[model samples]
Target: MYNKTIITIIRGALGMTDCKRLMEERRSVNFFDAAQPLTPELLRQIVELASLAPSAFNLQPWRLIAVRSPEGRERLWRLAQQQPKVLEAPVTLIVVGDRGAWQGDNPAWGELAAMLGGAEAVKPYLAMAEALYGATTERRIKFAESNAALLAMSVVYAARCFGVEGHFMSGIDFAGIKQAFALDEDEEVVMLLALGYAEGGKVLYPRRKRQSYDELVEEV
Candidate 1:
């Protein structure tokens, strides 16, 4: 019976059903049930999935400073152009970009690379990575900020899959937030996300359709 069950699992492995139905159901939920609070484990799970997003030269540059304190939330609300959601949401994350994560040889990358390939095999790649990404300060900051935005989107998508409503907010004073959090001046503020359960049925504005694939995409 165990062997049969294993066979059944293997048979379905390659053709496993997609979660696209859930994806289609997900929308930007502006209204949140503030009473239905999210737990740390759930937040960690969502972040874990988000952290899997792609980055240039494999430099994971995103940082999430989650705010839960009442005082802090109030301050955030004021900074967020006085948005009520900042105070009402169960969890608010301050997404930051670590602009210097890859400029130097990051220990995390070194360890992972060494584990996958030998240390000698990894040195040249690191050298090339540093030269390309670390050649100038501007290049580094741009790539890091870009990566942060991508990761932030991944977090929203991941939270949606986790059955949590995620709202991307850019209504805050970036400099004030950095100062409040004591973040490095050079670190870029990508955006913020409020995660919680959906409240009353959200009334969404009509979404603008995208350009046709042929119009947007060019075949080489």
Candidate 2:
């Protein structure tokens, strides 16, 4: 007998599976206990898992900067509107989308082509990515931002599986973050995530009401 409910609960706790119950259970966590730091290995695991998020043409056009060092975190804090959560959390991820992925000097083209059967097969895909996302400056940035947004959500859920919580935010000096982080001109910061463990056990806020299926879905 497969107890899916119980299984989901356990797997969700481990951050191994994406279940609706788990998604519903997670809330924006603030006030992380900085004393309870996340190990480097654990942080790596979470990022690697989240990197599996699908992207257009397998470009995976996002760059992640995990500010774990004290000095780095301090620099990031200054750019992030001096948010207390940014300083209190053990790690803060500067998630950005690189619009340069489709342009020249891009390595993803070679990598994706290798998987699908070498350069010949992937040439068209490379062209398509460029044509669609590289049509104009606005289109390029928006397409890149949309793809990176997917990775951001994946990261939030992946953190939950490791008993870690996150608070995703966008209120910041965008230019400051890029300057502090040395982000290239073609790269745009999508969001920042403060990651750490809660001081007490299970400090989940009450689940908020969401749009009903009827309101959310449409039967065509």
Candidate 3:
């Protein structure tokens, strides 16, 4: 069950006006307040909120390694191209995607089946997942990466609701991270997220120009 305090906090922070303001003001913070500490309880709450992100067949396949200790962050810093934020942020999350989550034997399938009605009701969905994601290696990788990306995005936004800032980093030594972390072969490293308060309570640069809707959108 979701925590009532967390639900209240989210409700207060995510009102229409606040939501729009948060979206516009959010930035990929480059400088983190190293002195400011993030409690494990708060971090867990952020992750719990992020878990609400959607996934195909309700098979949520993402995993996270929260590198919070100074030593752990130092190790992550090396793997992440020596990015200072990896160390400066109170926590860095190694987001992983399970490429084999769609398999029939996955426990999530059984749980989903129970929720839907029964095994019989879930058979078609299982077949569809297999047909869409299991036919080729490329398809399975795409499915994992895409769904994990969705979860990662949610993590960023969820952190913001608690006045935390986050930066997404993809320029990392993926192979080294996998080996160092001892990840399973089926787990794909999606991205790294640095989470903490911004140094001096704000970002350094003004918001950059974004493409206009007309340039970015197409009416088919």
Candidate 4:
């Protein structure tokens, strides 16, 4: 298990106000300043921060294809229903989820073993992951997509922390993306994230109304 004290300390440094502001300010930017491309170093930093997102058995199943090159972006734009944001954003990430990440060969298994004491300590976890995520083809896909979605949300928030904006787009050519990107059979495309500086550092429209907490929550 993770150290609660350490987690609390990190949260304290982040502060509740900062967290609230990030949640409130983040928007799906439709217009990106194409002239201001994301630097490789900045992109790396954002991804590294996003990777801290939690996952089942810590078997980080996510993969990303950063489409920054002109050719890559153009190809992705075509595969993504030609969304203008795909071409306008400085970088677009093809988020993929590996359904086979629960396998024993995954490096996360070894890392978890080391954290828990020894390789023997990971046996139960391995069995649990297999039983939960490997039951059927649909289950495997669910495991991958669910975990990748968490990482995708983290990427959006992490980018916002650095003054970068992001948009999550599911309108895509799934089969074409898989074929064009040459993904493995077990790798499922989760979504695409377009990231860049928003045009004029603002959104064209005001924030839309969201469901109230009372309307969304349920007491069971």
Candidate 5:
């Protein structure tokens, strides 16, 4: 028999183990099991989980439009240099991000300011938001794009956790994809994810040698 505290710790450890196992096992599978089609429920769940990813001031800029029709997939395949994986993959996801996600009402910052220094402190924070999100410049564009990229990666990871293989792709004609999908001009595709089961036992190609950790890391 195990003690209560030990049992609780064991449960927590098992949860962490499950998460870590999925992370370690996930791979970028290029070939997919063509027999199965990705379901709406699964797509919804994956997006919901991914929305929890950290964003700048909780601006949650990422949006996903899933292409399920064979015809739509065919069009996407053509846009992606006629990649067979785009056609064979059960689900084709177009990930978009709004460049102005932070311009709207920002309650999180106001709340935090109030918490840290009370109501009077929030006035400056509001001005800061106006300056940062209102002025559209190269620096701000890059900032939003960086956060959107992280959120996109989180979507791939979340899908993999649900036993769905993920392939992050950006090799498509951006204008064609937008026109074909009738996407709004304000929202732009940041990435694409091909989701399905792996075609064979192998989930991915073998890892290539990477730069040394020492060379990549700096303590400046």
Candidate 6:
């Protein structure tokens, strides 16, 4: 039998094998039931889970704008190559990466201090963020974007646990979205995820094939 402690940890952190089944069963649902939209509380919980993803120096550069309103969804629809799913889905999250996350020390360090119990507890982490991620603009931006990508995937996985399905879109007009949303110039739009319940008693196919463990893994 499995250790109860280990099983509890798994379930607490990311839920049981059922959560895995949710991910496996989920598909890139295009036709959504906007009428069956996620409640505000549920949306908050999903985003909360997505935010827990790790980031370099704990900067947590990800910023998600959930577009659930009529006008906002319409704008996204136009920016996203006229994809109907943009309009059909109840919420479309625009995940952005803030390149300037490591530029300063006050707010970020303040958060770290609170999280770690005191300023003294996380002073070294603060210094490390400045030393490593603050080296150059390119480094900062790359770190932010990469971390944001991790958070983006987490959003999908987290949403699935709530019986929500999603489809991530690419080739979006980043510039237009920036202009539309008035995002900071230093913020890069990483990706967009359309989220909602599937419509018309939707059925999903098997998860796409991935490289087998032997094919993708290597031992040193």
Judged by lDDT, which candidate is best? 4
lDDT (C-alpha, whole model) for all candidates: 0.79, 0.84, 0.90, 0.92, 0.76, 0.83
Task: Estimate the TM-score of every prediction.
Answer: 0.82, 0.85, 0.90, 0.92, 0.79, 0.83
Segments of candidate 2 deviating more than 4 angstroms: 1-18, 201-205
lDDT of 1 by residue, 1-220 (tens): 1233333343333323446655566676778887888899999999999999998667787688999778988888888898777788888999899777875456667775666576675676677767766678887777677889998889888988788888888877988888878888568777888888888776876655769999999999
Compare the candidates by TM-score and give the number of the best one: 4
Which lDDT tens digits does candidate 5 get at residues 1-220? 0132244343324577788878777777888889977788998898889888897666666678888889989989999888888888988888877676665454666566656577566566556655776576664565557777887788888888788888888988988888888877666777788988888774466866667989899978
Cα lDDT tens digits for candidate 6, 1-220: 0132243343336566776797667689878997887888999999898788887766788789999899999988999999998999989999999877875543766876776688787767666777777678877778778999999888988998788888998869988998899898778888899999899877666667889999999988
Order the candidates by lDDT, highest first — what do you get? Answer: 4, 3, 2, 6, 1, 5
lDDT of 1: 0.79
* TM-score leaderboard ranking: 4, 3, 2, 6, 1, 5
lDDT of 2 at 55: 82
lDDT of 4 by residue, 1-220 (tens): 5343344343326587989999988889899998998999999999999999999988999899999999999999999999999999999999999999999999999888888789998898899899999889988999999999999999999999999999999999988999999999989889999999999955468888899999999979
Clashes of each: 0, 1, 0, 0, 0, 0
Model 2 scores a C-alpha lDDT of 0.84
Span of 10 residues, lowest total lDDT, candidate 3: 1-10
Model 3 residue 9 distance off true place after TM-score fit, in angstroms? 21
Give the lDDT of residue 163 in candidate 5. Answer: 83
Question: Would you give me the overall lDDT of model 6?
Answer: 0.83
Model 3 spans > 4 angstroms off? 1-14, 201-203
Q: Candidate 4 lDDT (Cα, whole model)? A: 0.92
Model 1 segments more than 4 A misplaced: 1-18, 116-120
Report the Cα lDDT for candidate 5. Answer: 0.76
